[model samples]
Target: MSHATTSIAAEQDGPADIALSEFFDGHPVATFAIDTAHVVTHWNRACEQLLGWTKADMVGTANHWQAFYPRPRPLLADVIIAGAAGLESELERLYPGKHRRSALIPDAYEVEEFFPNIGASGHWLHFTAAPLRDGNGRVVGAIETLRDVTERRVAENALRRAHDNLEHVVDKRTGQLADINAKLQEDIAQRLLAEAELRRSNLELTELNQQLSRAQQQLLQADKLASIGQLAAGVAHEINNPIGYIFSNFRTLQNYLDQLFGMLDAYQRAEPSLAAPDAATLRALRERIDLDFLRQDIPTLMAESGEGIVRVRHIVQDLKDFSRVDANQEWVWADLHRGIDSTLNIVSNEVKYKADVVKEYGAIPDIQCLPLQINQVVMNLIVNAAHAIGDERGRITVRTGRDGDDHVWLEIGDNGSGIAPETVSRIFDPFFTTKAIGKGTGLGLSLAYGIVQKHSGRIDVDTALGQGTRFRVRLPIRHGAATEDPTA
Candidate 1:
């Protein structure tokens, strides 16, 4: 009914503008709004519940920052207002990092900042704000929504510190090994001590490496689950579109059936008439109910309902195939194109908003590998490609084909902001990212690297600042067939 009634109402009586524009309470996210004067005008229940400040205390005041700041610093909404009013330099002076325009929301800005007074130590708040416009299209105020991502931030920091420790070990052990070699050639007495130290270092390195691997894999799994949770909303919306129309169609069909049954009862009652039911009576009944229109529209409604069902089914299957819900990550000969297509479908929401995806697929044979793991790699590449493109209209080209007789290659290329030359080397390094806090875990490409390595393959990047970046993932036609290729 929502689908049908909305369209019908739209066609009959176009939408009306309302003056009471602020709807903070209706928003699912914790939200608050302020007027052009920077006075809080709308403070929602969620906001009050999250921030321990009620609407009565907030609404009509400019003391919003005191809730989350030590000395009333400008919040994300204030930064957006400053930027809108051409005070962008003030934004730079205030928030040097951790704040920027959100790629997901137009004309809105997002910031991830920690406020120590919010929780035990601090809570990382990810918030987005956009200028609110009145019915006359006048800039009235700005509204912001907030969410706490404290656990993820804590885990990320721990992982970063762990990575630093691992790096320190590498540096220390390299120097120790070089010294041990020099000393073993010169001094025989300390050889035992040096060998024992080397053994201890090796054991420590192994342990630290194991810890790093586990942290990275856990991060990858967490990221994957987060992706799925995000995808669930998009999938539900996609399914709802068809279901809504199908329901409307069914209602119309039910009405048609009622009218048809009424006409049949009329004919039966009039059967006992003098001339076996006068044609005029039945014709009048048909005309009253617009029987001719029903005859023309009923078949269309049924056909359209069938199409809607098929669409819903296809979306469901795509979700299942992308997740590999019942399938294990086992090696099998699979069509790489199929996996790419399914992964693309699953992440369509992420890309459709940022860039237009272009597939330049070539003839490729079935490759023997873990399909689900490869799909995960493809998903990460495509999502990263979309994010790289940012909010502007851009293109993401995915190309695939044989890389020689021994390897099959897949490349995801984006015509967006390219990576810096210096940053390219660390793009695949664990815990290294250019994304803002709460936006990435920095383990996506590293996980992809590990997956490729496990398949006896390699992932290489070609990037130039301002010219775009292309990630090429090449896998052996048969797993372990590439001689001397390292595995993770």
Candidate 2:
């Protein structure tokens, strides 16, 4: 025992070695020592905090294994004092591959393991143990230090799972993309025959559109209505032939698709009787393309496309109807509601972002006046209402009602910045405008005023600053001689 004096055994002596005991107890790392007999000699303050076992209970007992394991077993420090012959055998039975020789300490061993009995929830511990030698270099005891590495272990496991999941997703997507690329190559080869014809058609259409644009620019110098009329008429005449063939081709495509789907159905029914390799190949292709979903979605897509083409046709027709004021100025019986709707459709781009439009129409008879001129009047009023709106979103309301039996009235109003009294008096004067430069020509209200007068009608305005403005046009049921300008 005299050889144990210079080792950790010095701390086990009575009051004479109190300073040595205090020094070992003051260490920050969880540490404990065991003699050659496997008896606990020291347990530090950090070890007490780590396992909730006081130094008094642990310092003189061999029950240290109780803090880490359910049943008593030799801990790393106990194994370290067993001499080299028994040390390797004991570690192989307990720690196995988790033990490794410490890189920084000669003949010291380090191990990491999950100790289920360490706390309420288990903890992962990394501990190192080394033999304590006397002056003659004979092993008399062993000292072990411990660290809790539970958090690091948890993070490592999570990162491993995430990496594995990402690799699986990448492999699945790669297989799917390879299959689709093969199918796409086959489709592209078959469609190459039609690509040349489609390109030729596109080139012809582009040249025709350029010619029409030049014609439209020349006509714009004549007047607004004339330019619109020329463009609409030219587009309708030139584009309708192409649209007609396109619509017809869609029908032809539908028929071809029906025949192809019929052939595919027949092939599917005969698949079970085919050779094993052929059946497997067919099944793989169908899985790659998700053929069942495409079978359900293709008809829906075709129907939507057909509806879009029909809507385009109606839009072109509306354009022609809207621009007929200068093309045909004849007075004709027409539905005022229809005219208003067409006018709104033409100017929708101006008002959609600025304000929401609400229409309240009353049942009224057809008016015998120029349809295009009335549409023009409605467009001008609606455009003015939209321009009066400030930065915030606003509302524009259009109302129509029969004004007795011989006349009908149309009112367009907005929740916007109202016209000033001074400016209101001159709003209908040609070239008179309070608008910013390039935003207005100021002829819109003037043209509307003259058109109303031509139909022997009257235009009235009601407005207030910061509230809103309303313009009402009252027109005769039938066209008549020119009337005196009462509001002039």
- lDDT, candidate 2, 121-175, per-residue tens: 8899999999988789988789999999999999999999999999999999999
Residue by residue across 1-488, what tens digits does model 1's lDDT show?
Answer: 12344335336654331122235576667888776667776788888878888888987688998789879777878766654565456656766676687788788877787889885677888988898775797666688899978889999999999999999999999999999888777887688788999999999999999878866785666466556645754676677777778767777876887788688677757756636357667677879989778767876877787776777767776665666533455678888998899889988998888888899998889999877778889999999988888566999999998977888889999988899888877887878999999999898898887778778788888887776889988888887685433222
Which parts of model 2 are misplaced by more than 4 Å? 1-223, 325-327, 481-488
Most accurate candidate by lDDT = 2
Candidate 1 global lDDT: 0.78
lDDT value, residue 105 of candidate 2:
94
TM-score of each: 0.51, 0.52
lDDT (CA) per prediction: 0.78, 0.84
RMSD of each: 24.8, 30.0
Q: How many backbone clashes does candidate 1 have?
A: 0
